[model samples]
Target: MNTTEIFLIAMLIIFSLPWLVWRVFNTDYFAPLVVVQIIMGILLGPGVLGKWSPEYYQFVFTPAVVQSLNGIAWWAVMLFVMIAGVELDLAQAWKHRRESGITAGLALGSPLLLGCGAALVLLQFPGWMGPLAQHWQFVLGIGMACAVTALPILILLMEKLEILRHPLGQRILRYASLDDIAIWGVLALILMDWSRIGKQVVFLIAFVLLGWGFRRLMAWLQERDRWYVALIWLAACGFGADWAGLHYMVGAFLAGAIMDAHWFDQDRLDQLRHHVLLVMMPVFFLSTGLRTNWAVGGAEVFAAAALLLFVSVAGKLIGVRIAGRVLGWGPGEASVIGWLLQTKALIMIIFANILLDKQVITSETFTALLLMAVASTMLTVPVVAPRMSAHR
Candidate 1:
């Protein structure tokens, strides 16, 4: 078949198989459609499908076809990340700064320390660190990945639990918002290149000045006009960030972060997010799966994933529990909050993807991070549901 035929075939598998499995098996209670889609991405990746049927995998995922899909995936993820940025309730976080800081800090720091330790251990072995990575870069990158909370996925889970607007849910959102900012800040730090430092500095200054004008322009425009301008801004920021050597995704987040969520209709914004997930993000997931490799050996990769998962869960729970004590949270509150905060799927995956893209971590490490993210997210609802009910 031609490239177009092969690409369409690939898209067919990407969208259909995940939906069928999600519906047929009724996995929504424990594994939401998003979680199942992520798992399906893994199953469809080189590690599984390619291993089983090399020729079929290669035929369908030819370089040209993969390239075409990547273009879609890049834009899809950029839009998603930008939305995540716009949705960050930083104003609320600032309002609750003391509480938010304590929770967000411990929650992020503990996992980072533990994850760095794990990275240290992994450094002793081969096939984990990427060729371009410094020892410090590998350790810090993995450490931050462990500390990440997928704010977008967390919001989805909270909405599912019917607590998104509840007091406790709002509290959780505040904590996550602060951590979200820190996550990107650390990413910028890790991605900084001495050679390109000047360019990055220039980009930041220009962004600040242009972002001010952009925000003002957005505020004056009608809502309908704002949407088109926002897309144009996204494209520009993505290009500028890529040019600055900080990655286009960073630019995408900045594009949204600078814009006020109040400038658009909340319901429509939510609908846009839903539609993006429905239509485009599965392509991102498939492309992500396409990047997975088991060259380090399946057992080894699984071991690394298990290791990362343990630290991510343990550190999050430990840190949150500490915060609960300091804040005098009610009995069992920490457990509930901890479990909810431990949810990691999209954001952690995105962070690891950046690390993988920058060659700070090998594909083996990326595969492991992918597995850890899926497992971490899958545990959130099942583990927290009963605890939440007990309290109710």
Candidate 2:
């Protein structure tokens, strides 16, 4: 078959397998279609399907087909990240400054500290740290991964629970929004290249000026024109960030972060996100899965993943519990909020992917982190649903 046929075949498999599993197994309550797709990606990767059927894997995922898929995944993820950036309602977060700041700080810092400890333990073993990473870089990267809250996924889950517009849900969004900014800021710090500092500095300055002008332009344009302009901005920012050695995903986030979400229709924005996930993100997941390696041993990877998950969940709960005490939240509020804040699906995966791309963490570590993200996200709805219902 030609490359086109092979790529289509790959896409068909990517889209179909996850849906079949979600429907046939009725995993929606626990494992959403996105979660199933992520697992499916890993299963179809070299560690599982490729190992069992190297010939088939190679034939289906040829170099040309892989490249094609990667292109789609890149744009897909960029758009998704941009949406995440635009969704950041920092204004509301600031309006609830004391509450949001206290919760966001502890929520992020506690996991970071615990995750750093976990990273320290992993460092004792070989095959965990990436080649290009300094000891500090690897440690900090993993720690931050554990601390990350998937704001986009959190929003989705909140909407599903019918609390998206509720006061409690709005408060959760504020906390997550604050943490989201910190997460990206720390990522920029981690990705800083001393050798390319000049370029990065220049990029930042240029980004500010361009952002101001772009925002002005966006305000002037009709909503329909804004969508096209946003894509153009996305491409430009992505290229500039990649050129500055900070990664295009960071650029994508910045591109949307500076823009006002209210400029576009909320329903359209939500639909765009959903369509991206439906059509493009599965390919990204498959590509992500293709990178998973268990050379360090599957048992070790699972163990590490479990350790990360434990610290991630525990730290978030403990930190939020502290905040709850200080703020005098009603009983059960902290637990519910803590569990909801622990959702780490897409953003954590994206963060880990950047780490892997930068060689800040090895494939084994990536696999473990990926597993932790999946497990962490899966736990959110199951744990939080009952709490939310009871609290209501």
Candidate 3:
């Protein structure tokens, strides 16, 4: 719609070439690909590019660019969900479902309590959000987002470091998948802006039933190569949730959980991950960096950031360890597995972004949490991956 948008578009295309080239040549530093794209977005964003020549920047920031970039980001998320769904060893995961479920619940619950405990005292702000923040719902959400470990980054780290098949990796993967869903469900509960408990219950029943039926039909059809049928299911799951007052991620996660890919094929899932990471994900990260407003979110945000990062990492590690001990796990084994599973990724980012976009979170909150995620991703991934591999 504006000149600034147009310039950003041209620049994104120009920048994407180098990113794509680098992706093919070397996959060594995939994390930095996200960093680089964000930097590009910031440079082209209001402060630098727009400041230099407002008119020129406006040309770059056209309506077309806005629409296209947003579309690409959405596509990346779909790929992320598909990969997540496809890789799941549902049968194995379900067989160990009790252990997995316990680990997941504790892993989610502990961080949630810790983050909310910190937020109540430290993350104080005034005015409109304060009312919402005062409620347990906001506290629950911020806590969950703060505590999530990135599943995608963990998989990448475990693979690159040659630890994916290790005992520690296996244990962590089993627990993390369960934990990811548990945490998401908790958020879904918080997100259901209903006035009464009965209303919420009704909504859940309708949502789950619709989701189950849709997924069953999808599996039946897709087993027969019916992608057109798959598309209808996708629309139902996605738009259906939008209509029902839930996030698309809920529907997407439900879709993944229900389609229930069997574990006989690992290579196809791996290929799917490769295709998504190489082609589409940079756009998502680009959108992340562009949406972020680091300039205004300075000193105050960092304090909250430090707390969120620490609480998130520590609580999950401790909770998982506690669960392991309860299940008669060895201390060293539990520690390694706990540490390995705590790395967070795209789902975490999207959750935080959703809150931010809904105006439920401040820009400062969003920026700090997101950047902390990037940092935590960098830190925890390398450490646990190597340790897990050696232990195996």
Candidate 4:
């Protein structure tokens, strides 16, 4: 078949197979459609599908076809990340600074330290660190991955539980929002290139000045015009960041972070996010899968994944429990909060993807992180639902 025909075949598989399995088996109670989509991506990746049927994998995921898919995935994820940024309720976080700080700090810090420790162990082995990574970059990159909470996915899960607008749900959003800032801040630090330090510095300064002007422009524009202008801004910021050697994803996040969410109509903004996920994010997941490899051995990758999962889950729970004690949270609150905050789905995958792109971690490490993300996300609803029910 021609490239276009094969690409369509690939798209059909991406959109259909996962939905069929999700609808048929009814995995929503334990695994939502998004989590299932991620799993399917891994299964369809080279590690699994290529190993099982190399010829078919090569035939469909040809170079031309893969390139076309990647373009879609890149734009899709950029839009998603920008929305996550625009939606960050920093004003709410600041209003309850003391509580938010205590919770956010522990939630992020405990996992980071433990994850760094795990990275240390992985460093002792071969095939874990990428070729271009310095020791510190690899360690910090892995550490941050463990600490990441997928704010986008967390919001989705909370909405699923019917708590998104509730007081408790709003509190969780506050904590996650604070951590989201730190997560991207750390990412910029990790992707910092000393050789291009001047360029990065220039980019930051220019972004600040231009960002001010952009915000003013957005403020004066009609709502419909704002949407078009935002896309233009997203593309420009992405290009500037990539040119500065900080990666387009960093620029994408910044593009949304500077804009006030209140500027847009809440309902319309929510719909746009929903549509982006529905239409675009599956391609990103599949593209992520295409990069997975098990050259370090499946058993070894699984072991690493298990190790990361333990630290990520344990660290978040421990840290949150400590915060609960300090703040005198009611009984059962911490467990529910901990489980909800421990989610590491899309954001963690994005973090690992950036690391892999920069060669800070090998495909083997990326595969393990991917597995950890899928498992971690799958555990959230099942574990939190019962606790939430008891409280209700």
Candidate 5:
């Protein structure tokens, strides 16, 4: 068969299988289609399907077909990350600086500390850290992965729970928004290549100047014109960042971060995000899945995943509870907020992917982190739903 035919078959599997499972089992209450899709990606990956039927896997996911799918996935994730950046309401976060800072700090810092400790334990073993990583890089990267909260996924979950527009929901956004900024900052630190430091410095300086002009230009353009201009800007920023030895994903985030979300219609921006997820992100998910491995052993990977999940969930809850006490939050507030903050899916996976790409973490570590992300996300709805009901 032609490469195009094989690629189409891959796409068919990517889109169809997850939706079928979600619908057939009526798993919406616990496992949303997104969650189902992620799980399906793992099941379809080399660790599972490829292991079982290497011939069929190779036939469908030929080198050409994989390359084609990767192109789509790259663009998909770039757009998705850009949208996440565009949605950041820094102004609002600033307005609630005290509360947001306290909450976001503890929420992020606690898990980071705990995850670092976990990474230390894992270091005693082989096959966990990447070949290119230094001890500090590996620890910090894994720590930050645990601390990450997927803002996009959090928004989606909040909307599902019918609290997206509520005051509580707005507050959660503020906390998550602050942490989102920190997540990228830490990512930049992790990606720093000392030999290319000069280029990275130049890129930052140019980014700031260009960003100023770009924002002004965006402000001047009509909403209809801004969309096309934004894509052009996205491509340029991504290229510049990649050239500077910083990842293009960072550049994509910056491209959208500087542009005011108000410049475009909110409904249109939301629709664009939804459409990207519907049409493109499944390809990204599949590509991510294809990278999963269990050379360290499947049981070991699951064990590591469970350990990370424990620290991630416990640390978030503990930190938030501390914040609640210090800030004097009402009863049950911390529990609900903590559970919501613990949700990690797209953003954490993206962070892990970057770590994997940078050779800061091995595929074994990536697989474990991926499992933790999926399991943590699945826990969000079930745990938060009951608490939200009680509050209501």
Candidate 6:
């Protein structure tokens, strides 16, 4: 079959499957929104029936499709990041500074610490197929992914539930935002310091100054002028990473952060995010699902994957619970935050991308991680939602 036929079929499944899931499952609990999309991928992916007929996998998940999926996924991620960054209105959460501190510590620190601890332990296992720690950079990348929280989704969920403007809501937003900042810092540091560049401190300062200057320059432009300017500068930053000793994501993130700081309006950014959700984001999720080489499945690997998943969930529960108590939340509230915020999606993509780029983790492992992410997000929201009223 021609590429066009393959692409069209992939598109059909991408658009149709979500609606089908909504129809199939009378409710969205076990068969959640994201899970349905993921299953769409598994249905076409190397996991189940695809193994019998590799031709189907090839037709649907072609290189062209893969590239297109990457494009959509990146845009979805960009919209998600911009939304997360702009909504971090420190002014609104300022009153909850004390409680925010407690929540932030327990919320962010516990996961990060546990993740790092797990990474250290996992490092000893010659090669888990999940990592290729030629350098600690790869190890740190996985650890960072584990530590991250879904801030944008968390905020949207909180707002949907109408707790965003309340005191607990404000505290949760602030705490989550703080966690995002911490996650960004860890991400930046990982991307930045990865190069064994000489004069590392000098490079770090210059990168920040460059980012700052770019932000100021964009802020100085007309709104229409700014998008073009931002586009050009981001292109330049991409080239800068290729030319200099820096990662492309560092430049991409800085570009986003700068716009987030000054030029982009939250409402406008969110509206763009709306387009992203409808098309780009679904393409992205579907792409990841197809790429999930679950043909690498086995009882042994399943055992390993389960251990990793359990450690991830339990560590967050224990660590965040302690952190919640420290942050001034009652045990009940902290337990909820620990369970809810531990939902990992965006980081799954980032880590998978990093491994794919670095050749650190295999396609199979990336797929497994995606499965873990979808499962966590599927479980987190419903479990946390009913409790929203309970907590109140």
Worst 10 residues of 2 by lDDT: 380-389
Q: Give the Cα error of residue 336 in candidate 4, in Å.
A: 0.7
Over 295-364, each residue of candidate 3 has an lDDT whose tens digit, in order, gives 5444655666787788878887788888888888864666666665656656678788677655666666
Q: In model 6, what are the clashing residue pairs, if there are any?
A: 102-327, 106-323
Candidate 5, residues 1-392, lDDT tens digits: the string is 99889999999999999999999999988888888888888889999999999999999999999999999998999999999999999999999899999999999999999999999989999999998899999999999999999999999999999998999999999999999999999999989999999999999999999888898899899999999999999998999999999898999888888888899899999899989988999888899999999989999999999999999999999999999999999999999999999999999999999999999999999999999999999999999999989988
Clash count of each predicted structure: 0, 0, 26, 0, 0, 2
* Model 6 residue 94 CA deviation in Å: 7.2
For model 3, where is the 10-residue window of minimal lDDT? 126-135
For model 5, what is the alpha-carbon lDDT of residue 234?
Answer: 94
Off-target runs (Cα >4 Å) in candidate 2 are: none
* TM per prediction: 0.99, 0.99, 0.82, 0.99, 0.99, 0.82
lDDT of each: 0.93, 0.95, 0.65, 0.95, 0.93, 0.62
1-392 per-residue lDDT for model 4 (tens digits)? 78889999999999998899999999998889888899999999999999999999999999999999999999999999999999999999999999999999999999999999999999999999999999999999998899999999999999999999999999999999999999999999999999999999999999999999999999999998999999999999999999999999999999999999988999999999899989999999999999999999999999999999999999999999999999999999999999999999999999999999999999999999999999999999999999999999
In candidate 1, which residue pairs clash?
none
Off by over 4 Å in 3: 1-57, 127-134, 195-219, 222-228, 263-265, 328-331, 389-392
Mark the regions of model 4 whose C-alpha exceeds 4 Å error after superposition.
none
Q: Please, what are the lDDT tens digits per residue for candidate 6 over residues 227-295?
A: 667667666654555345454554555556555534666566667656656666677667666655644
Error of 2 at 329 (Å): 0.3
Q: How many residue-pair clashes does candidate 1 contain? A: 0
Model 6 clashes, total count: 2
For model 2, residues 280-354, the per-residue Cα lDDT tens digits are 899999999999999999999999999999999999999999999999999999999999998999999999999
